[model samples]
Target chain A: MSPPLAPPGWSRWLVPPAALSVHLAIGQAYAWSVFKPPLEAALHLDGTQSALPFQLAIVMLGLSAAFGGTLVERKGPRWAMTVALVCFSSGFLISALGAWTEQYWLIVLGYGFVGGIGLGIGYISPVSTLIKWFPDRPGMATGIAIMGFGGGALIASPWSAQMLESFGADPTGIALAFLVHGLSYAVFMALGVFLVRVPRPADRAAAAGGPSAAEGVRVSARSAVRTPQFWCLWIVLCTNVTAGIGILEKAAPMITDFFADSSGPVSASAAAGFVALLSAANMAGRIGWSSTSDLIGRKNIYRVYLGVGALMYLTIALFGDSAKPLFVVCALVILSFYGGGFATIPAYLKDLFGTYQVGAIHGRLLTAWSTAGVLGPLIVNWIADRQEEAGRHGSSLYGLSFAIMIGLLVVGFVANEFVRPVHPRHHLPAPPKEAADVQRQQSA
Target chain B: MSSDSSPPRGTRNGLIAFAWVWVGAPLGYGLYELVRKATQLFTG
Candidate 1:
């Protein structure tokens, strides 16, 4: 309940770097798939068995984020960051032990569940705090911090792969790799916890624009759910996530297969590099694309995302295994947009509803991610897997999946269009003055 | 342009606006796409 302290001389701009350090490190979750094939080969596991850790990790990310939203709002960013550091690092430790012991369930418990809590807490921690620091530009502040999440994999994918190769790619080697990740990240994320500071009362006073400022709206968490806007956004995010993750989870293999029949096919090393390129695109989109949303208005920007994204999915489906460059370009563009979406949504909510409890609102909204995390992959993977079983190769297996993605985008488009201005009726009256204004106007 | 040597209030506000725009725009575009693609899956 104490007022946050301000720095002696430094302006608030210093905080974004503090938030990014943790995000970039934890965002390494995207790079996790890089180790999948090696682990499978070494352990003699099937594709489904090999994918268990990743699947469980995704499930935990959504579930924990959904459940942990209020706790995060009540506790400040420091506590959340501390929990994230311990849980995330512990996940790696537990998984490392699991790897050494050759117990898959232990790996699931440690890496998937324990590590997942870290991912969720780290994601939400600095969001509202950053918004408070730069109230004039919530989108940009959150974007810079959140961008680290998408981009984190850019460092991890290749680096982890090298370490695995150097240490040996077998189970014991994998255990060592996990051990290093756990220890190193603990130190890296701790720096963010130390650096982060909530905006001081004066800054909040300045940013909140005083009592005379636009009577800022506050929506309770329980009531926010009742509004049509929340459901519309849920549909919008769920579909976007479903479409992007389907491709992301299978990026390496999908790229190789897509380019296989082309005149200039992607080689094995190139395929791995290609996933890295997508990581770059994902990272860049988080910074470049979402930041763009600040100018165009959130709704208008989403129109472009949904509309253009569907076209990109269609291009890949229609083009099939054709020009190699076209395939890469389109996939990169789509991936960038996917990253952009993750970065921009916080700002979008801030615009629609004032900053009151937006971090919690954003947390509630992430249930869409949990839903899509399962649904997107299931739709795409199941279709692709079944078709592969049916002897469908080349572009045939993914055609149905791409079409499904398009359908999801269209549904989101309708929901986006449906968003009306949140009426005064939906808001609680501003303290006294606004209520007096209403009384005066009515008497007149 | 103002004849006065002093910076105008409008100019300062504009600069502040531009800073916010630069940072927020890309993320706005990005989240819009996320929602678009999310809904697209079900409709199609």
Candidate 2:
């Protein structure tokens, strides 16, 4: 059956809020840390044990996104958003049950596996539709939606913390928090599902002559994965993300370690402040850098992100402990690049491969994030632990990690330089009956 | 892009306002925390 398009009177601008509603709600994933300490104390689990739900959720996010990408493209945003709502909210409800029953593995299955699928699907649910709706400003359109992901934790952190504080951190309290989160997000995401509308072929045809012109080689997701350009970008995204996450995963502690020996040491509260600043920088950078991409072009903006990103890391590696403000400013800029990297990539995919299956392609590309999520934290934390064990103090503890980050950013910069337009051979040929059949089977 | 097939300006305006408020409520809350945290960081 053909999908319904926006009515003649529909406003394109409303689509962004539809996207943001889901992104903002699912972005609560980032706030999982707020529950960590409480879960550990209440459940009598170790830090690593308590972290299983979150870790598994990330793993599931990548896998589900990879497996579900084509389905999202085939099924449409409303269907994808509905599935995301069901899986995501139910994951929370199930986690609530798990918590109440004191079953750690159930929490892992509920929040990790089930909720992770919600995250993956919810994350990519709006990309292609948004590109179609605002083809003239794909970057800015996507930036607005993706920015909510970065900002999700900011709202969730305080809210979840307050819930835990008010309701008590015990299993019942945590379960109630989960229940509230699940139900509210379900309602929030439903708004997106209702508001989202697919662009009809007629609207697309009308758009072709104007700012929304289709001027690039369009590849199907299956063909896109086969192109060298996709892998190059994969390398670029992975390395850039790895470099940023190295600092992010350890932001609070890294700041304290850097300023430990200063005349006025950074207190724990101040360290938390540093984290909040990074979050703000991250959110700001998404909208700021992405909108700039629409002006300067995507490639140029990425050069700034990857190349200048390396320089920012070098600044910290050399002069980090020399001045606290320098450290803070450098960290903020690096974090902005991190956020920008994420917000820009969907638009970048649109630029390279066109909007045909950009959402599915994007879903596949997120595996890089899942990979970087592990590699980044592992590299930084492992090195930091070893340094501390060796009695290294202060800035030296992280100096090595920062230098390594510089090297990785430079590598990603080279990869970005090598990224070229997808070759014509990779483009999906004019749709034929047999080709449609093959495509259907492939997506199936 | 031309608005030949688009909604009226008033409807668009109302929608833009509603859309902003819908997403902005949560985002505004987040920004409020951001401001609070920034204040704590700089004041000390």
Q: Which candidate gets the maximum DockQ versus the true structure?
A: 2
Alpha-carbon runs more than 4 Å astray in model 1: A1-4, A7-10, A34-46, A169-172, A205-215, A252-262, A320-322, A386-392, A425-444, B1-44
Work out candidate 1's RMSD over C-alphas.
Answer: 9.1
Error of 2 at A2 (Å): 6.1
Candidate 2 structure quality by residue, lDDT tens digits, A1-444: 234467765777778999999999889999998889988987899988988888888898898888899999998888888888999999999999998998878888999999999999999999899888877777898999899988788889899999899989999999999999999889878778777888654454444433232533568999999998899889888998998898899998898888888898888778878888898999999989998898898889989999999999999989988998999999999999998989999989999998889999999999999889988999899999999999999989988888888888898999999998888888775456534543444454
Say what the RMSD of model 2 is: 4.9
DockQ of each: 0.03, 0.33
> What lDDT score is found at residue A203 in candidate 1?
57
lDDT by residue (tens digit), candidate 1, A117-183: 8988888888878887777667778888888787566567656888898999888999999999999
TM-score of each: 0.81, 0.93
Best by lDDT: 2
